[model samples]
Target chain A: MTAPNASPVQSRPLWGAGKTVVLLVGAAILWSYLGTGSNLLLPFQADGRHQVALFFSQLFPPNLSASLLTRALRGSLETLAVSIMGTLLAVLIGFPLGALSAYTVMGNRRFSEAEGSSAVARLWRRLIYDGSTLLLNFLRSVPELFWALIFIVAVGLGPFPGVLALGFHTGGVLGKLYSESLEALDSRPLEALQATGASTLKVFLFGMVPLALPQLLSYTLYRWEVNIRTAAVLGVVGAGGLGQDILVAMGLLHYQDLATFLIATLAIVIAVDFLSTFLRLRLIPS
Target chain B: MAPSIEIENLVKVFDGRVAALDSLSLQVEEGEKVALIGPSGAGKTTLFRLLNCILTPTRGTLRLQGCDVTRLSEKSLRELRARIGTIYQQHNLVPQLRVAHNVLAGKLGRLSTARALWNFWDPRPDGDVVRALTQVGIAGKYWERTAALSGGQQQRVAVARALVQNPDILLADEPVSSVDPALAQEIVSLLADLAQEGGKTLVVSLHSVELALAHFPRIVGLRGGKLYFDLPPDQITAELLSGLFTRCEAERGVPERVLRGAVSPVFPLDSPYDKA
Candidate 1:
């Protein structure tokens, strides 16, 4: 067969080029119209712009009084505590769930023709796998704010509820990440372990966990960083911490106090980001 | 004495379509060293996996030390596997762990969970692991991370791990394939020597027919999911190897020269078994 005389770059339209451009432009226009219709385009109206400008003007001089500063410091510390505790709890809850949900660890035996295992045993394993996955999905699907609200109703308003909220949601997030990393690991080592007659738990602890540890630790640290931000937001539901302080200040139109709390939250987030990044790099090295 | 391994009419069909091993029958006596040789698609690895109990045959029985593997319970299988060690082409060591820990992993099957977890912190490099590492010439580097070692060194570590297992049969599937050509011969020779000295049955799969002929006393040729020949090394001939490799293609009615174009050129140039 003779080779066709074709140019490398054929004269054809790029994939989805025309349609994507049209859809994007149309979406932008629709968004703008919706914004105006819903009175969300505050700067587009004279009265609304004045109100916004006045609001910003009031927020400039932050309340750095001795009493308020002390309160804000205390709230910030609570937020930090909530984040750390929540992250720890999430790791505690997620680690096993992740291991159980991972096909490499838990579901591997089911697919293999495990000698002398009855149908009932296989059915039980299948149920555990499916149940754990469903639980993780349900936990992650509900927002942290919703969790805080539910906890507040159950346990009353406190930083404890906020911690539980963050822990539950972040647990799901960490579970998914942990399972994916575990599943994606080189299975050869695990296979070698299995061939040596190592039990499932032994294989997991010695073979799978060691290989996936660095990635799992990195993911956990990343989730901790996210939980710090979520913890601040969870406080808005009166679960305690800086978010609650911000909500109280907003309710009383204490814009300066709100500005101070916002600044503190940003500073805390930046600090945690720096710490998590340093830890991830130093430990994982890759 | 019972044979170390016996497979009768073994068949393995993957995905219910491709037959990886077809009605293969073989037996290896205790302390015997055999080499499995064939092209890429041959069932050498499959046979090794079956021997290691990593894979189950679709329609045949495999007896390891007179124990019918296919009929054994999970607990019995575990006990059976504890007596058979497998080495892989990639070495299959946990790279981030220390060599001592990797070697000690051999005992995980026998150790209790508490002891296993404790061993991680204090990888109690007992006499056996030390001796195994010493045998592999990496005793001093036991505390070092396995990833820091070179490819050949890593494979030696794998050998040490298998050694620590103290198995009756060592199944190495393309154990030297990932190493450089110079080290390949040394690794194979080391494995052969270890098996001989320890009186352990060794079955290795090799891509190079020369290596197989040089090291192993017996060579089993597999082609197209079936055993082509099982003979002593002295009986292997150039014509036999060429015929074994090209038989599947030739059976389809293609011309022999056209199908053997790439492989035939090298057969006369360097094959040590050409004269035999």
Candidate 2:
């Protein structure tokens, strides 16, 4: 007989779904540690600690010279411009793709159903939906760094390549996010619009746009914050930003200059975060 | 002239098993004001949705102004639906939009895509939007965000939205079920009076027998996807109401509360509008 105090939840076996997942993750971590031959205690070792200390000591008393500061500032500005341009382009490319991928975002009321309608119409919708999903998957699967490398080859180095790379990668990311937000929207308002005999475009504008704008903007702004950091790193591939300056300083053993550039990157990232947060509050209702 | 709506042997089965509406036949003549009353699961919403052309009948014919809705093209169906304005229980207004924009949504069918988008941003102080709002007595809250309004005020906005549509037939699916009895009576009277003024046909579903009996000339009672009775308010007997309510409540495992005279149903309204 079951225990008198046992509830259905308490009756579950010891190896429940939660415990199984925890065990699997623990096993995977152990396997990875063994496979990679990683040394967790290396930093605590005497010789390794001395090397780490020497590298860190070089990072202090960062160069505050006017020339280096000016260069760092210019690089930071370039990175900012790249991120803004990339984000703008991403919106342009992603908005339509995102809308097309989500079945609910589209205007056809009949299309919402699984049955009825001409086979040809259904086929067309299916193709568009699948095609958008596939394209978005491909675009995002390739990292921004890889895209930067490709664009550098095609357009020849500098901020333009960085812009194109971030645009391509972030467009995919934003499109997926935008489609999810659109799908997650409260459908009743949309149905109310559709019932009014409004055309698909009109329904989208009046119903979907109003409901989705704040959410879509929030996603785009958050992505912009991420793109700023990526834009800096794109400079490692000669795509142009503070990362290039940092890379040069390191290559030449100019740790002081590297330190200054690192600080500049940190300052800019914080600035963008603050600005995006402010804009989110001002534009989107709580 | 053709009747505003016609249904013959209408049947709607959800997921091929659960029938929301059965072989029901109904006809609403031009400019008629009808009330639908039944228990919670009586398929009143299904009937309204079928009338609005949003839900297709599984096996029957539905005609709007003599147009066979099932056979119509998508484009043609939309044109037909534009003439039917529907008010939902939740009000269904986009919460983030301005009250004026929600009201102007009634004109979406009439406006082109570009014009509708333009209107969303800068609604020309067309006397129509202002006039519709004024009629509903919320003209002062035109630019206010829709969510900021109270439940009763939101209901007014919903009415204003329907008015702006200038539809030939108005379908209100339990429009006042969430409001208090006093506000419910006011809204019902307003809808009936508006329909009379515009000479538009109206079909409103109500949980309150008293509201239906007082404002509507004819009442249609439904039970379990089938019509129980179709009669004028004077012909409806207390025995008939008690039988209907008692049987419905018993099926839901609630103790029977017999109807006496014109008393309305009492709801547990901890917070109005929180129900939805």
Candidate 3:
């Protein structure tokens, strides 16, 4: 049993990439386990954790109150309308313009003509793309609440401002998404199309559109989901929807009312999620 | 028909450093199946590009079917390109589209924009697409996607596309390089047939000297962006080939077998590329 001078059977050395990957995964899980949105200190979480427990307990006495449920249901409908309108507008307006912006579709001539070949032209294309990106950042950055606050000032407190805010930001985000999709396409078809005496828009409409449709649909659906979330928070700034009703209930110390709002919001979100998933899957090619 | 092509004092420089084509002048009469043979860096593709107006010349004039190619605009170039069919080594068929669509793309330039876009009403090359496919021996596989076809079949589709165009002049850039010897011979024969019918001029750049000698009546040799030989294929001696291949070695007369016929030693297999 006298083995040669080999360091005792070190249990597979714990050294290669698989071990590294497992260790990284374990570290991530451990970090997620320890962290909540707030600090690890006990004081701030105690009250919130208690509220969650109380809310769970109230499930038996689940807010079966009829009139309150009806109002929450109505608020959910408003949220749906805001999301649909915003997404439709984004898809309708952004698709064609996005195709025009792509180098794959437009070629060096159209691009160089619109911009140029020099550093100035490169800077120009970049500046235009960046301007749109900045606009998207501005729209998505303010977190819907601030937009609703600003809109509520001018439009005087309603779901109209919430819808407007959603439309504005979603349009910007979708436009950028669509333009990038156009850029990533195979250029050969567009070149073939353009070389056939087709105009830029015609090439986009015929050649690029059908090819890019799946990407466009997926991005639009994603934006719709985002808009639904944004619509819920609009009430925080008095832009309207379920948020407004929830805000009032919270102000009145209506814990049971809060429960009803949360349940309705959850139901609406789940429904939208299911519908969007089905649509995106259907729109995607096999 | 007038001469299929006429190039006079054609000069093109890319980035002003590389002389892609230097004062290159050439002409091909109707129904002439001319083969251009050259080594790497000999400016074969550059000449094709300039002839088709895909790239403008830095200096000189080009005339196709007696019209000044140098004077054409982008739109006119598209029309000119339709008249002059080009086949690349890669067969350049849009892989995503169906073979039918790619082949019928022959009508893309000839038809109105709306007709081409809608495509439903475009009967421009309706029966011609099928006929061309039949000629290329892939008539049965028209509806399939282009990628589904083999390399030989894809190249046949490229030829079918050009045939559907019903072009007056055919320009092929190493059309057989992607296929095997048997298929290469068949393709060369097909080009020869196109030229024979109604005097269509077929100009092809070939990598094989044997194929060129057997299939082409006229051969143009290029060396370092300059024309070295423009003579009858019957007169294409091994000495001339060696000169084209190497200026120093060519001064001595070549061996008899080479002068008679040289079997291209590249691949062992000979004849039809694989079946469609």
Candidate 4:
């Protein structure tokens, strides 16, 4: 028999996780009561709407005019500018915050002592992340067309307003991304830094930031690609871009020209995606 | 003649339910090496936390070198932290950074914040990093990352980091408990050397009583938030150790392997540690 005092600790299941799932299911049921079942309020233009036959005919021509391709290139440039500006803004702001947002001061790490005493710090960190996340949710929640519409009123729609909206919205997203990367970092370095008497901030920059950087930059670039697409749609709000030009072409019933704009946009987005993927891979240390 | 650390009725409660450290009291003379041993909960870890000033006592007195720490301001407390260096059982060294960076970290509290930030980009600082590494017998691998080394080497890096601080008091919690037999002895010997040769007052909490008695001349046995035994190695009899395993018949035997019925000489005067 073991020593009398060496009794096993009472084994209990971790109850908190089970209760959260139950609460989620209950909340969903309660929320459904206030709403109508039909989703007809959504703006989904069904198949038979808006020149269905003629629109296809226009698309069949697939505007490949040399002169038109060059004009389409200008619109693509605006898209590129939006993605570049948005991703840069997001990366610069998000990277450090991601590290701070991590569980471990060294990026998503679980330190022995920090795990016990850092509940308050953890709450504050989660609050900062969730607050920024809500901001991004609000921004993305409003479709690019809405942002463009508002910006058209405030700043006179151009690629500029599209860039502004993407920068603000994606900045939040990238921050969350970067913080996640920061949190997941190896914590030993931070402790090593701590042993030397380095403050929290110093530990983050030296130990956490370098480790999370490639992933943070990569995520920001991916967001930039989305921002570029959003910028194209924002043009419909008088926010000047390919979207505005497409609007004019459609309004004039220039099916061939609209086709050209669509094809060119697809090509540019593809190129941007390819380049970003390559660079992100290259930036990581093996 | 001054006491490096003084404690009286130190208590710590977590969630106001679990008493991590109960009303405990102790004192450490300047340059003396002390090994604290207990089963698991004898409040050894909590007492170390209290002495390190990382965790404040809910109700007690802690005076370090004539300074009343119970009422120290935030700035004064941080200054106090800078003076006391800590080494954990698991070397909490950052894996990505070079060994030199971890060693240089020991100087951070003494450096200005601006200088510290600048060091992140450029961690090298002349002979300071090399000298620290040399003291720990890891001089050739300063450029390697902290994790690339074996467990013992990493612990040595931790020692180098602490040595860089030039601390007045060294606190190592379960220092060599994680390593293998030979390496554990090496770590204990290093810590002992730090106390005797370097003359830094050191306090280490350990689970192995053999390692404790083998190295430290002074051993403080804790049981249920009380001191079960506090005596020099010369005065420690089998009967005193019997109180430690009062209820366990199997564990009550003399565990020292140097010689049967041997007490003090299991510890050497030149190197007071087990070889194997």
Model 2 per-residue lDDT tens digits across residues A1-286: 8888788575567577899899999999999999999998998899989999998899999999999999999999999999999999999878889988876754234312212346586678888988998898888899999999999999997999999999999999999998888777766677678788886667777887779999999999999999999989999989898989988999999998999999999999999999999999999988
For model 3 the local lDDT of residue A78 reads 83
Instruction: Report fnat for all candidates as fractions from 0 to 1.
Output: 0.58, 0.52, 0.07, 0.28
**TM-score of candidate 4 to 2 decimals:** 0.74
Alpha-carbon runs more than 4 Å astray in model 3: A1-78, A103-164, A189-202, A210-218, A234-245, A260-286, B1-3, B67-70, B120-125, B242-276
lDDT of 1 at A75: 90
DockQ of each: 0.35, 0.39, 0.11, 0.18
Best by lDDT: 2
TM-score of each model, in listed order: 0.87, 0.91, 0.71, 0.74
> Largest DockQ belongs to which candidate?
2
Between candidates 2 and 3, the DockQ winner: 2
TM-score (C-alpha) between model 1 and the true structure: 0.87
lDDT of candidate 3 over B34-107, digit per residue (tens): 89997655678767755655556678877888878656555566676667777766635667567887776666
Per-candidate TM-score, chain A:
0.85, 0.90, 0.73, 0.70
Best-to-worst ranking by lDDT: 2, 1, 3, 4
Off by over 4 Å in 2: A1-23, A107-118, B248-276
What global local distance difference test value does model 1 have? 0.82
Off-target runs (Cα >4 Å) in candidate 4 are A1-54, A92-147, A176-197, A203-222, A238-241, A272-286, B123-125, B147-150, B245-276
Selected candidate, larger TM-score, 3 vs 4: 4
Interface RMSD of 1: 7.9
* Candidate number that wins on TM-score, 1 or 4: 1
Candidate 2 local distance difference test against the native: 0.83
Over A1-286, each residue of candidate 4 has an lDDT whose tens digit, in order, gives 8789885886677777889999999988778855646454333466444557656786778677788877888888877887687667656655555444454553222322322224565567678756655565565466555655676678875777776666666666776666667655544445445444455666566666655666666777678668777777777666666887889998998888988888877787788778877887787544
